[model samples]
Target: MFGNDVRLKLKMACRLLGGQKSVANSAHIDNSNFGKWLKGQPTLSEENIQAVLTAMGLPDGEPDTKNIHCWNIKNSFLNNLSSALSLYFPYTAEMARAPWVVQGPSLKDTLGIGDAPNTLYALTDGKTRAILRMPRSVIIQENNVLPVIKWRNDTPEKSVLLIEEIKSGWVTGVPTVKEFDLAWNAQGHQVTDHDVLQAIKDADISNKEAVRRIKQKK
Candidate 1:
């Protein structure tokens, strides 16, 4: 599924950037290797994937694009659909669990979004995790004057949930407790439930109501 998703995205990237040759040149990847990727003659590498995204002027992140086949944006601030299309990327599942910084094209002038911040953090929790649980791509949009993310369901019913972005980027998916523990330990702070809750509060990615609900669930 990941391969197919990469192929699908690669084809689309090539089209948007011009063609296979253009992509190869822009990404600085060898033409033969690029062709091999298209033909499935060899396995796709992280390096090539990053190169493709770089050529496309998208953020460089380890987004699991393979699990996602389609993405649909609703009520986007950007007037140009093509420009909005560049917003989609396969973020790693772990990155999805917490807020992380991502750099991309300045979205300010494009739709009055504002200037590129010296640093910006993406929120990757709550509804973003729910969507990934369904194993689908997310739809990016704005709600209540904040960036909201939701699952892009491809079914006929098209059930979706729109939640505010963790900060800006949505989580790729949930992470295991062990992974969470490792992350906490790596932070070099004494681990405690209070500490974890405090960290979440400091991040400001999860809504107060949502956080309250989560605590209640626990």
Candidate 2:
């Protein structure tokens, strides 16, 4: 029986994780039931709560990942490329080589005394380190060689207006999208966030079942 605050978190989890169906599947609950329960149809259940939280990338016993943030640009663009590639080739699972990354507890938060101060990061691709915040983007910069759009040089003014809100460019020429596509086709994501979440849920369920069995035997 979680309150509105917890309920709101469940909703936010859905947004971050794509949607209700995605969350429901990972939690191993029916989509409709999951929606209703979070909506307070009959209130929340502890079992379902744990499943959902773990599916949303929270560790066991943790209330939520309010402080943790995770992202992967390759996945974001590859998802787009998947949509694009599907239009041309008969797409398969192998065609998609992206992982939904989930960040764990921060050392600063877990080990530090009080509130963590704001900090700017100059990240790296193991070779280059740069800080490119793009003025307003939440993503300061990922120093990896990634896609870029010469949106202004050759692309039409009408097209620029179409993607006006998109914050692209600053990487003059890294790796071409074509090369990225080729490499993506050659390899598949070994394990994905979905796999991790499902494994966490499965392990949790297995542990509980084992405990129940031991109790029954006793």
Structural similarity to truth (TM-score) of each candidate = 0.28, 0.31
Clashes of each: 11, 0
How far out, in Å, is residue 119 in model 2?
Answer: 20
lDDT (10s digit) by residue, model 1, range 36-62: 777666645778867776665543633
88 in model 2: Cα distance from truth in Å? Answer: 39
Clashes of 1: 11
List per-prediction Cα lDDT, in the order shown. Answer: 0.40, 0.38
Q: Which run of 10 residues does model 1 get worst, by summed lDDT?
A: 127-136
Task: Assess candidate 2 and give its lDDT.
Answer: 0.38
Root-mean-square deviation of Cα positions for candidate 2 versus the true structure, in angstroms: 26.2
